[model samples]
Target: MSTQVLSPPVAAVRLEQVTKRYGSGPAAVTALRGIDLALPRGAFTAVMGPSGSGKSTFLHCAAGLDQPTSGSVWLGDTDISRLKPRALTVFRRDHVGFVFQAYNLLPALSVEQNITLPLLLAGRGADPGWLDFVTGAVGLADLRGRRPSELSGGQQQRVAIARALVTRPDAVFADEPTGALDSRTGRQVLELLRRTAEELGQTVVMVTHDPIAASYADRVLFLADGAFVGHLDRPSAQQVADHMTHLGEW
Candidate 1:
C-alpha cells in the first residue's frame, strides 16, 4: 500500500495584480494599483494608510465586498473576482466574516440571536457546541439573553465579535472595528480579535488609521497612493506612528 500525504491549507486570501478604477478614460480614478498580496491562514494583518490612500478600497476588494477593475482575487483558490453578483453574495456569506465599527446588531434581538443571525440568514442550523464556544470566548456567556441595548459599548462590540466568529469563515474583515469605542473598551475588543486569530485559527484583515489599533496585528502593511509601501512585523504603536508621519497627513 502507498502512503498518502496532505498538503497544508491554501492561503486564506490572495490578491494578484489587482486594480480598481472609479471611472473610464481621462476621468478615471485609480484606487488600487496592481496590488499583490497573500494572507496566510490563521494570521492577522492590519492595513494602514493616509486618507485617500486606498486603505478602505484595499480591504473592500480583498474581502469581496467590492470588485476590482483588473486582476484576480482568490479566497482559497476560488476566483471570487469572477463571481457573479448573486454568487458573490452567497460566497461571501458562506466564506467571509465581517466586523465593522457600527456594531450592526438588531436592537430587537438578544445577544445570542444577534450572534447567530448570520447562520440563520444562511439557512443553516447553529452548532450548539460552536455557539457555546464563541459566546464564552467573547465573554458573553452570561448575557446571551440580553439585548444589544442592555450592554455597554465594549460588551456590544464583544457581541459583534462573537457573531463574526460564529460561522468560522475563512477570513474576517474588520473596518475600523474599534473606531467607535473608548480607548479602554477598544483595547478589550482588539484583545479579543487577537485572541480569535491566535487561538481559533482564523485569518483577519483590518483597516484602521490608528497606530494603537494596528499594533494588535501580527503584521502591519502600510499603503500609500494605492500601493503597498512598507510593512512591519510585531510592530509597536510608536513605530507605526513614525512610519505614518513619514508618509505625510494620513
Candidate 2:
C-alpha cells in the first residue's frame, strides 16, 4: 500500500520576521519587532494593546496597506511585501478587504452602489446574484436604495460591512470597527463580524481596545512595546479586562 502524505494547510495570513521602523537613525522609532504569526482560515482573531503598542502598525503591514522594512507578509501564498507599489495596490484591492471605524462611504451613492464600489474600482462589473447575496447577508437588502446620509449609524456600518464582504477577499481587517457606535449597536456589529467567520468561513482580524469587543473573537493576542506579550482563548470580558490592566498603565 502506498502511504498518503498530507501537507499542512496554508495559512490565510502569515508574517515572517516582520519589522517596521519609522526613520533611519537616532530619532528613529521601531513600531514592530521581528514578529511572526500565521492565522488559520476561518479564524476570528483579535489584537489588543495599550496606546502606542504598535497595533495599527501590525494591521497596516499584515493587510498590505504598508510595507515592512524587513521580512515578508504573505496573504495566502503571495508575498505582498515583495510586490511593487502598483501591483501591491492591485493585490490589496482584489484580495484584501478593510473596515475602519469611520465607515468610509460616499454620501452620494446608494447603499447598493457603495457595496459594489470595490468591484467597480477593480474594473469588474458586479455579479447581480453575488451583490444581492452580500447586501442581504448584511441586512441591507431593504435599504439598498437609500444613501449613506439617510441611514442610521448602525445601518451605515452595516453598509460598510457589506462593502468589505462584496469582494469575497481572502481576509478582512477591521480596525476598531465599532468604535463609533454605542454599546448596543457595537455589539450588533461585533455579532455580524463573528457570523462572517462562523457561517462564511472567512478569516477575520480585528484590532480593538474594548475588552468586551475582544471577547467576541476566538482568541485575543496582546501586544506591548512592539512585540506580542500574551494571548487568551475564548476568555470572558472580565478576564480580558484584567489581562489588559496588567499590561501597563492605560
Candidate 3:
C-alpha cells in the first residue's frame, strides 16, 4: 500500500530572516529584526503594533518599497530585494497594488481614468468586461464620469479600492486605509476589502492600529520592538484589543 503526500500551498509573499536598519553608526535604529513570515495566497492578514513597533517597516519591506539590510523578500517565485531600482519599479507596478489613507488620485482625471491609470502606465489596454466588473464591484459604475472633487471621502476611498483591484495584481497592501474616514465609512471600506479577498481570491495585507479594523482580517500579527510577538486567528475586536493591551508582555 502507498500513501500520497500533499504539498503545502506556496506562499504569495515570504520573508526569510529579514532585517532592516537605518543609518550605520551607534545611533542607527533597527526597524526589523529577523522577520520570518509567509503570507498565504487568497487570505487577509492584518498587522498591528504600538507606535514605532516596525509595522511600517514590515509593510515597506514586504511590498518592495524598501529593501532589507540583510535577508530576502520573495514575491511568489521572484526575489524582489535583489532587483535594481528600475526593474523593481516595473515589477511592482505589474504585480502589486496599494491602497493608502490619503486616497492618492489625480484630481483632473475621471473616475474611470483614475481606476485605469495603472494599466495605461503599463502601456496596456483595459479589458472592457473586467473594467465593467471592477466598477460594478466597487459601486462606482454610475460615477465613472465624475472626478475626485465631486465625491465624498468614502466615495473617494471606494474609488481607491477600485483602482487597486483594476490590475488584478497578486496582492494588495493597504496602509491605514480607513484612517481618514468616519467609523461608519471606515466599516464600509473594511467590508469592501474583506469582500474583495473572499470573492475575488485576492491576497491582502493591511496595517492598522484599530482592533475593529484588525477583526476583519482572517489573521492578525502583532509586532513589537522590531520583532513579531504573537498572532491571532479569526480574531474578534475585543480579543484583538486584549492581545494588543498585553503586547509588551509577549
Candidate 4:
C-alpha cells in the first residue's frame, strides 16, 4: 500500500459483499460481483473502468440510488440497502449528495435557487454559514443570479457542484462529473472537487473514465467485471495510463 492508503481518512464509507443483478438465471447479468471497498472521510477518490466494468452500478449502489442485489452499502453508520423508499429519500437528502455528467440544474431556476432546491424539497433550511462557504469555495458568488443557460459548461457544472456541496452531506457521489467539459475546464472542476475534500473535510467518490480526472483523486480504484481489480494512490495521469495499459483496458 502507498502511504496515501495508510493515511487516516476524515470520514469513511464502506461496502461489504455488494452485488447487483438484472433479470434471473441465464438472462441475468451481474452488474456488480460481491465487491467490497472503503472510501475514507475527507478523501477525494475516483473510480475508473472500461465500458462495461460495472462502474455505474457501483456508483448507484454507493449513493443508495439503486439497491444492491445482496450485501450491504454503508454510508457512515447507515446501511442504505435497508431503508424504505420514503426513509431512503430522507436519508439521501440529509446525508448524501450527488453530481453527474449532466449538470441537472433546473432550466428556470437561478444558481442560488438550484443550489438550495434540494434543501427546500426536504423541508429543511440551509445553514447560512455553509451556504456562504460553498458558494465562495466554488467561486460562484457573482454568478448565483444567473440561470444555467446563461453560463458556460464549466460554470454550469460548478453550480452542480455547489448544489452538491450546499447540503454539506456526509459524502458526495459524482459520476463522470467532468466528462462534458474541455480538458482545461475539466481540470478546474477537478481541482475544485479536491479542494472541497481537503479544505472542508468533505468526502467525495467520483466515477470517471478520464485518466487526467482520476489523477486528481487522493486515491483511485480500478474496476473490472464488477469487481475491484486494483487501486492507485496519489497517481499521475501517466502512471494510471501505464497501469491501465498493463490491465488490458487502455
Clash counts per candidate, in order, are: 0, 0, 0, 1
> What RMSD does each model have against the real structure?
2.0, 1.3, 1.5, 4.7
Off by over 4 Å in 1: 1-9
- Cα lDDT tens digits, model 4, 1-250, are 6565564543368899999999998999998999888777899999998889899999999999999999998988789899998999899988898998999999999999999999999888888888887898998989889989999999999999999888778899999999999989999999999999999889999999889899999999998888888999999999888777765542
Question: How many steric overlaps does candidate 4 have?
Answer: 1
TM-score of each: 0.95, 0.98, 0.96, 0.94
Candidate 1 lDDT over 1-250, as tens digits, reads 9999999768999999999999889999999999999899989999998999999999999889999999999998799999999999999988888998999999999999999998999999999999999999999999999999899999998998888888888899999999999999999999988999999989999999999999999999999999998999989999999999887643
lDDT of 2 by residue, 12-52 (tens): 99999999999888999999999999999999999999999
Best by TM-score: 2
Query: At residue 139, what lDDT does model 4 achieve?
Result: 88
| Model 3 stretches with alpha carbons more than 4 Å out | 1-7
**Global lDDT of model 2:** 0.94
Model with the higher TM-score, candidate 2 or 4: 2
How many residue pairs clash in model 3? 0
Better of 1 and 2 by TM-score: 2
